[model samples]
Target chain A: MKDKDGVSGVDSSSSGVNRRDFLKVGATAAAVAGASSVGMAESATAASFNPKKFAGTTVKILLVDGERDQEGIKDKISYIQKTHGIKVEVTALALGAQLEKIQSVLHAPTSEYDIIDNLGFTVSGVVGGGLFTKLNDYIANKELTASTYNYPADFPAGQLDYTSRYDVAKNKFGGKDVYLIPGMHSGSVIMFYRKDLLAAAGIPVPKNWDDYIDAARKLNTGGVSGTTMIAANDVSLILVDWYARFASMGGKLMSGTPGAKNYKPNLNGATAVRAVQHMIDCAEVSPKGVGSFGFTESVDAFSRGDVALMLCWSTIAGSAFNPATSKVASKIGAVQIPGDANTSGRPIRGGWGLGIPKNLPQKRKDAAWMVMQYITSAEFDKYQFDKYQTDPNRRGTYVDAALNKKYPYLKVAGQAMENAKMLDVALIPECFELVGEAAREFNLAIIGSQTAKQACANAQASWEKILKRAGHLA
Target chain B: MLYSLGISFFEFDRVAGKWNFLGLGNYKEILSDKVFWSSILVTGVMVGVALIVEVVAGVSLAIFFGQKLKGSKFVRAILITPMILNPVVVGLMWRALLNPQWGLINWFIGLFGIDNPPIWLADPKWTLWTLIFVDIWQWTPFIFVVVFARYQALPMDVFESARVDGASPLKIIRYITLPLVSSAVVFAAIFRGIDSFRTFDLVYGLTFGGPGRSTTTLSFYSFENGFVYYRYGFASALSYIMVIMATIGFSVLLKWIPVRRNH
Candidate 1:
């Protein structure tokens, strides 16, 4: 079977099914798709369509701990079991442990998990590794999904390209093949500001990096920092903070496409340096230890009304508008991160997806997919958002009138999500290496240890070395 | 150890889900890698400075507690409080205390009319030393507890004779007390040295080996490569190199630092 990246010659030993058998099942499944009774199972509401079809059977799922994705499942496990008659067993692990678990289990002859969640950044590594079953046939089977399920169209178009589809033949993303389903939560970096502070200081919302810096300086008084952001030794600095600024300034992330011999990071360009310089300028108006702050610290500063502005992940900073958790709950405003004349601010695409492992039995895969369909459906999307305030993945929920009224930022955040740009370098498995090297050097620049030019040059050198070692650079 | 050693010769291809033979390529690259070398230097400095400070301070506290003064038991209990806390918790506790904006440490310093204190965790120049200071605070009590027990077991006859001979307290400590506790100090040093040499969680909780990789220890560096980058072969090689360096360093330390054992 072909992997997500289109790589052939997968070791069938683990799946206990040779290529011939795999193709036979796929061909059979494809031919008999319309005749299957999976989606056609009787139900009261298509959204709550649960059947006892897999009665007394168990489907094991793996979820990332500490995320709303896991919380949603734990909250409704009993309902799922009672409705579907499929016992749901969940194994939730922290991000690192979860990834390791995926790797080890998928490689074993008989995998333990029937369903698993993949972080967006690791999609290329996990899903691309041919660990998950090709979900296109399952999705195309009308009997399994409801008429209102609207699998692909329901999710943001960009997320489907980034986190769900993989061109197995071309070994790249944006492929026609669907191997994963984007759900649980999805978000991007957006600017969050104190409306009260900005209005009091007579400063309009920043439209570009220059204006952002100017507003920060003007608002830096009265014991409040003008702005704050993640600049510490963190990958988010690269994904959420630096990349947003650099991309907004029209700096491309990669010089060449994945699998190209000349693939390298576009780190030392003029626009990249200018973006770094902008971060340094803004650092002057940030809190005293802003250089060391991550999302939590920066968001806490904004929540406590100590910072006037911030560029944060909508999922993290969403709490700032909750009365119970924030001091500025009624006083803050949200917008797309400011962009330059050449480009609109396109924050990094961020989210997670759920998929079925390829090694699972046919019955388990069906049961797991049924559970997945229920959880990611539009009905459940609205349900989760209302109950847990999860970062909504379904487009309908993002533009929901009630949600928009209660959370004023919903409309703006929805726009940001629809237009979010993913890093080109993330299409390859060497994503963390590229981002981590640049994050370290840019952090040095933000902390005043090096000039922007020097930091960019250093990052470029490191990227060159890493790409060469990864065989992406010649 | 053997499995890691085996993987050191093969490069893991994440997309292909297979391993490629690299022989000594990982080791060769790591030898010239500046970041690996810097991590080694940071680890060395952290272990050396923390070991010395903890040993010295532990002995001083041990001597003070050995005086058997009023409320000595309560003070002794307080002295070993930090030793029992997890290293990660200690790192997090100190991270808050060192926060330049609202931390108690800077606030206490501000009471003396100072403003604009240094950003301890953010500044590359001071981050390594700050980590060392935090490690010392947490582990120093381990040495004190070990040596204090030895001090309590020491016979009183020697101290009585020293005082009768008109030996001052300082002289008595320098010649008699120190010699008796040297063995305990050496034992504590070896244990603390090994523990500090492989420090990962503390650094992860504190600065995450950063600002600009200023505080990246060897273990954390290996973790970044293996888990974050998925360069299994290179990470395995790097870890083995650390093992070799630590082995040789400890061997020499055990030889050079003599501990006298009194009958």
Candidate 2:
């Protein structure tokens, strides 16, 4: 085929045109055309890109172990070394601690790992701090091929939106090409309850805020707390849950567009105030120490059969129903979070992604990109689901017969994904701290120290202050 | 001296690398922050309350153990056990013990005919006090050990002289014993005060400055702003404020300790 620029080809028959010169020119033209046609693809077959053959070279990765994907770090390292010829060192850190560690490392020039598994929020920090290599050139140069890369398409639109940068001028994402790959996506705030208990109480599983309140009140009657949620001073979990419930109630934390540094506070409106009030009411029926409880306390309360319902992550369903982990496992059941007046059928999405750190050497980055491709591939998603019970983030993986049988809950979780909204706080990093602080103030009101109105007012004031300090106030 | 010593370094170049020197602009921003002021007030209250509790209980325990009583040695060792355990471990253990649902404290409350026990850590009004309890439980013994050792080292003649003067036990304690041990008390308070101001591991491990920022001290606030939120400049400003507050506290404490007198 002729090049788009219509450059003339060398004469093959002329004796003046050496065979070698003709071949080199022909190859160079073909290469340039190929690179332009499909960005980030090298002229190599997927079958030949064997990561296992690069054994002597070691790569370090940081990942969080979700409930479903609790792969033993040793086994993963060993398999990568044996199969791909590369020695992989994986450090599986807890969710919160990992965020802290990533923030500290990214702030400095040199990073501890060749690759870091970061969420969209952390990726924003990495981007803002110029910590990650811009993949636009690499993608355009065909150094990273999407066909061989196997980027999962099953991640919800919100998850994709969260990870990809928004070019305000273009009003499009993934337009600048990929910066981070959606590693794993799961629903952040899922409403779970003891199915048996709800049935026994003659109350149906709640489908909306009114029903939820009624069910909680009924559950609170039998010496059991109505619902368990993270209300402690740690704002990340609390705000995620708050946003989930608020979205269900037709409220939003902020308005404008993603990656816009100057967004207005849409959370202090009437809808937001009502959402805060509902949470305060829920707190009344919660366990005695609900305000002080973090993730562990909330989960423990639900798992121990002391609480009738819990609004948490989809990853928590397995733990809540595991006999070893929960006393109420046999009676527990999972469902979508109840909707509020505004949002009658929306679930919140909370999970992280994999991105190339800017500080990595070019060769190391190439290697790291390969690893990300391998893990996020269709074959790997199957392996992850079958071996570890981790649900895949790809659409095809959700319908895979084998995965459905092994983890029936994934079907429900997958359904929740269709209605998933990215927890608003994750988009703005400072919002996490602000929301957490606001939630604590709300908790103070819930426990009767502060009135519900007072709590809302305090939260609005606090949130406004944070936005002002971040130069985002409208 | 500053140039020769690598330890006494500042990131002047890094600071000047990007932004203009606002000359304490960040500090000005911090001073104007209500959260900053609130954090300062919280830390002050926590330190003051914790110190007072530690001193009273510590002094009493030291005086009690100073007496020659049966099983006093065993009690002393048991009381000091909390200090030996890691602060994180101690925090977790107490969290379990004070847990509203399954904790022993709540279980005992049930025995008292109470329907629902107050969630010690969960209640905003009670959260700070709960942290205080944990701090006192862990560190009161340090004070006890110090005060007890000093009490034992007091010359026997001083008490004998008070006794010969027909002084009552209360009078002897107030006039003689108290004055002699005042130096040791000052030293312990200074050390403990500084340590308490920087307390992170135990409080973080226990409450994480939660139930609505009721338990957040200056250090916790600094951590949240710096690492969690990635506001390095703001965090640096908070750190400097902490340093100033600590320095002032130390200076005021040192004034009470007699530099010339060897106790």
Off by over 4 Å in 2: A1-46, A64-71, A92-96, A134-149, A154-157, A164-176, A236-238, A257-262, A340-342, A377-391, A425-429, B1-21, B68-70, B151-180, B257-263
> Deviation in angstroms for A46 in model 2?
6.3
Task: Write the residue-wise lDDT of candidate 1 on B206-240 in tens digits.
Answer: 98889887999999999878877778899999999
Tens digits of per-residue lDDT for model 2, A1-474: 112322111222321232244334334433432332232223244434434433467777887754544363344556556555567777777666778777666656767776677665455445444455555554344335444343323444545665644332343333444566666544445677888788889997787777888889888977788887777665644445666667767776676644365666665677666766777788879988777677777888888888998777665554665567779767777666777443444656555666777767777777776566556555565566555544455545555555556455555565555446655545444646676667677667666777766776777777777776555554
Among these predictions, the greatest TM-score belongs to 1
Docking class of 2: acceptable
Interface quality of candidate 1 as DockQ = 0.71
Least accurate 10 contiguous residues by lDDT in model 2 chain A: A1-10
Candidate 1 matches the true fold with a TM-score of 0.90
| Model 1 Cα shift for residue B41 (angstroms) | 1.3
What's the lDDT for residue B229 in model 1? Answer: 77
In model 1, where do residues sit more than 4 Å from their true spots?
Answer: A1-50, A55-61, A65-67, A86-94, A110-112, A142-144, A361-363, B161-167
